[model samples]
Target: MTDGDDMKNGSGPAAHSGWRGGHAPRWGTAACVAAVAALLAGLPWAAHGRLPGRLATHWSGGAAPDGSMPLWAAAVFPAGIWLLIALVVSLSRRRARAGARPWRGLVLAPTGTVLVGAQASVVRANLDRTDWHEARQPVWAIVLILALTGAALAVAWRIAVHVASATPAIAPPELDLPEGERLAWFSHAANPWLQLLSAAACLVATGTLVALGVGLASPEALWPVFAVCGVIALASGVFSSVRAKVSEAGLEVAFGPLGWPARRWSPAAIESARAEQRRPSEVGGWGYRLSGHGTTVMLRAGDCLVVRPRGRRSDFAVSVDDAERGAALLNALRRRDRAGIG
Candidate 1:
């Protein structure tokens, strides 16, 4: 049987037999419901006034009522507290699993914090009806949100370290290959760093442009900025779509927006290709990336195929659905090239 078939039958280590039959966790469902209830309860607070303390005043537009917190603050405070509580509950549940480690929770905490902080900021921004340029309210709100976000991240990192200490270490599988194929196999591994750098650069550039007042400062200008960001994000998606296809003609790469433009390369130009495992973080969290070492195409996590050019030392890696099959096809093409046969 083909390796793919073996995987489907759960004979392979990567096979997921429980995917279809698995039941949803009751605790997770309960936590989500509770969070939603908390958010709903806070809606009245968010609609009318400001919160307490320095953050409360900063977040509340100066129009906040005397001696009373803003509705927006009331809503956000409860939601934030609920979020923290839910996270703690979820982490406890995860810890109950056999060999479960606290480190996983720690790693994910920052992401949760950022999400909540961003949500709160967005809600506050929407609540205030003032124009961005005239009121200059959003700028201060953004700063406050960022400060809170930073604090949350610091706490998350500390939590992650503690969790990592308690978690059991699992040994990675040994990749066995024929002696002559070792180099070929290694080249196919996907690296995610390239895509992450690209995304980070895009964010930095856009933020810089906004800060420099290059774009319209009015809230209406926000749409155009968002559109530009969308275009950048789409570029990566198009690249990923192209990387997934493998056929007898050669490898087809998607290049343009909506994959309108494509590039085709013959097997003759492909020196070596192989499959490799990739973690979500290592591969730029799933998108197209061009690294200093080589190009990386990824869309989600799992196995990837790395292809090297015939005379070049550097290799390009792409995440694909059937990486092993793609690697086999590349190997066949390489053999054909060596024999001077198509």
Candidate 2:
């Protein structure tokens, strides 16, 4: 799941892992995002003279128009949102360098554009109208838009999953544990940087919502703000901490409180384990990273244990303290499992 130009490329496990990142696939996905947004944003303009010059963009109570905008603004607002998404992606890419997940942005940008277009579609129908009840959006139109958006999201995720799974696995260096020591390894790690990032994102979302409420932005734009806040809160929960353990049973990775639904590899599942040093670019930046070669739960990125599980094309790398000891223990337990030792 990682790699870079300055990274030391060695033989026999020093550095058998790297990325197959290509710009063609990246740009293909971005184009897909923009194209979908363009098509949806064009709906009102295509309808042309049938619509009015001023549009009722929002409603109050249940049936009266409380907010309005120029027809041109209403027509192109979704496209503007699409461009804004592109700009944000560009900035993040510049900041991240090797940390950027452009593939993810491929999924996010278009899905957001679709949802924005859905809302605008209703407003387009209500143009030149003052009565909210008469201008109420058609239920069928809303339902259809939702259905399409959901389908598009599912397809995009499937594509990303395929790309991730196709990543090549790197073999870990062979090792043996200390004499007289039973096979076992355990360690816990917390990423304060990730917690701080999530907290900052949540605060920004809260600020934006406040601004929208005070009329700094369109009142109807609250849905996207709410969605952003919820996602940040969830990230705050899932990536706050990570725990890795290897024993006779297998290799287990548990994240967050109590680790209720952890990812585990049975004794028969792990192919190899090793202690390794990693760069941020190798794992595609911070907080539970994914790359063309594997997946990594990274914090500051230094010492890590890379695990290759059986029947999978990619490996797993987790940044933690005492990874050398843990990797040795893991290899020992794997040997014990093969020998059926007590």
lDDT of each: 0.46, 0.59
Worst 10 residues of 1 by lDDT: 14-23
Please give the distance, in angstroms, between residue 121's alpha carbon in candidate 2 and its true position after superposition: 35
- The lDDT of model 1 is 0.46
RMSD of each: 14.0, 15.1
lDDT tens string, model 2, 270-325?
89989889988877887788997599888656888888988888989988766876
The residue-by-residue lDDT of candidate 1 on 155-212, one tens digit each, is: 6566445333322222222222232332111111212333333344444333433322
For candidate 2, the lDDT comes to 0.59
Query: With candidate 1 superimposed using the best TM-score fit, by how many Å does residue 147's alpha carbon deviate from the native?
Result: 46
